[model samples]
Target: MDLASYAELAIELVNSSDPAEDSLRDLDSLQRLLRIRPHLGGRVTRRDLDAMRELRDSLRAVFTAAARGDHADAVDRLNTLLIQHPVQPQLSGHDGQCWHLHLTESGSVPDRYAAGAAMGLAVLISDRGVDRLGVCAAEGCGNVFFDTTVDRSRRHCSPQCAGRSNGIP
Candidate 1:
């Protein structure tokens, strides 16, 4: 399931767009994100940017549902994404590395991102538990995150948010 790899992709995608501001405001921003994660690289377009924004919202809903203790809703939302994206598992050693699982798809950049992110979240929820998905608990920050803490006590999306919430800076 290459959980960390794919799950981080999902988290990055969701975090790129937040209630306060959207990092993916143009084709250039979207391309930059894809450059950061070459697995989802492609010739992006305006349509792709629009689609990615939509995908961000959909993925955020899954985290929101999980945070609310609505497992059924979270599962349902993820299921819809899986059906829409339909990722195919494959093994690839793309950079002269050992063979590892990779979720591949044939479509636009947004489509590929959607497939990988949806499949990753689905596997993560089933293997670790839905509670592993979460929304930032810091006030005014709606970024979503995949909790990796041993105690599952993650409350903010990042250390900066945590510090701000604690009045540490």
Candidate 2:
């Protein structure tokens, strides 16, 4: 399974807005985020947006711990999250596509997202190793990312950040 892709959901949630700078502190931004990640179905509410933000922080911590070479801490945090939001895996398919694994069948918006994120991150660390988790090395950009490069030397979270760090205008 391509758990690495699912694991990147954590990165997406963290990099939604700059943590050390800007933040998506409104319902509209939350809605827009959900639009991009359609797997997190169900109605969203203000409380849910709050919960998601908190969950985002927790997920970020996981990456931070992993990047620091503290895999135990990352695993511990992910374990608690997984227990809190258990994945109810089921096969799903539509639009002439073959069935693929789905995380949760039913839950609140945050629960569904947390469940999938937790499980995906778990699988990711297990299969790929904790070294795959990373934090950007760009100045003023404390973003989280998965190091999927063949040589695993990805220093910045994005090409834009790479250019900025490399003194590109």
Candidate 3:
């Protein structure tokens, strides 16, 4: 996925309540997890999609730390990543794409994607609060999620994830 789309998806994937479910099985699952709000006719790939999964795992760490209300740990993790894989934003796409910056080079692996997403979340937490990260309260599923809700009371990634985790019949 493109950088913008990756950013959008990062928000949703980190906030999803069911990381182990079918929603995460498709190529677009990464986009969905990051909440990219896919467009029709968009091409997706799973052959080289390992980066997306890596993104998921890395995000899981951040969300898990956030869920526990440990801002220090989350920040430290993100910072370590930044130090290890520093990136500078530059414009390269021919489409102009608003001339936005990217945290990693083109064709980056999942690690780059994960680092970028974590960096974004870290910024959000530093500016907003650690309460933005959350987890499903359902019985079996302990998936991590991002709370973009204005009220900050979101409890699950989706109704289905919530119901399944809660043992609702």
Best by lDDT: 1
List per-prediction Cα lDDT, in the order shown. 0.83, 0.82, 0.60
Candidate scoring better on lDDT of 1 and 2: 1
Please rank every candidate by lDDT, starting with the best.
Answer: 1, 2, 3
lDDT (10s digit) by residue, model 3, range 1-169: 3343444445555545354564557666645543433221133467536545555566667667778888788667667656655555555554655556566554344445555665666566666677787777776666666677888878986788767766776
- Candidate 2 matches the true fold with a TM-score of 0.91
TM-score of each: 0.91, 0.91, 0.62
Question: Which pairs of residues collide in candidate 2?
Answer: none
Clashes of each: 0, 0, 10
Once model 2 is optimally superposed onto the true structure by TM-score, how far is the C-alpha of residue 41 displaced, in angstroms? 2.7
lDDT of 1 by residue, 69-137 (tens): 998999999999999988777888877888888787467788878888888787787788999898998
What tens-digit string does per-residue lDDT give for candidate 2 at 1-169? 3455677677778887675444458877777777877777568888998899899989989989988999899889989999998888888885677888877778898888888788888887888788888999999888888887889898889899999999996
lDDT of 1 at 92: 83
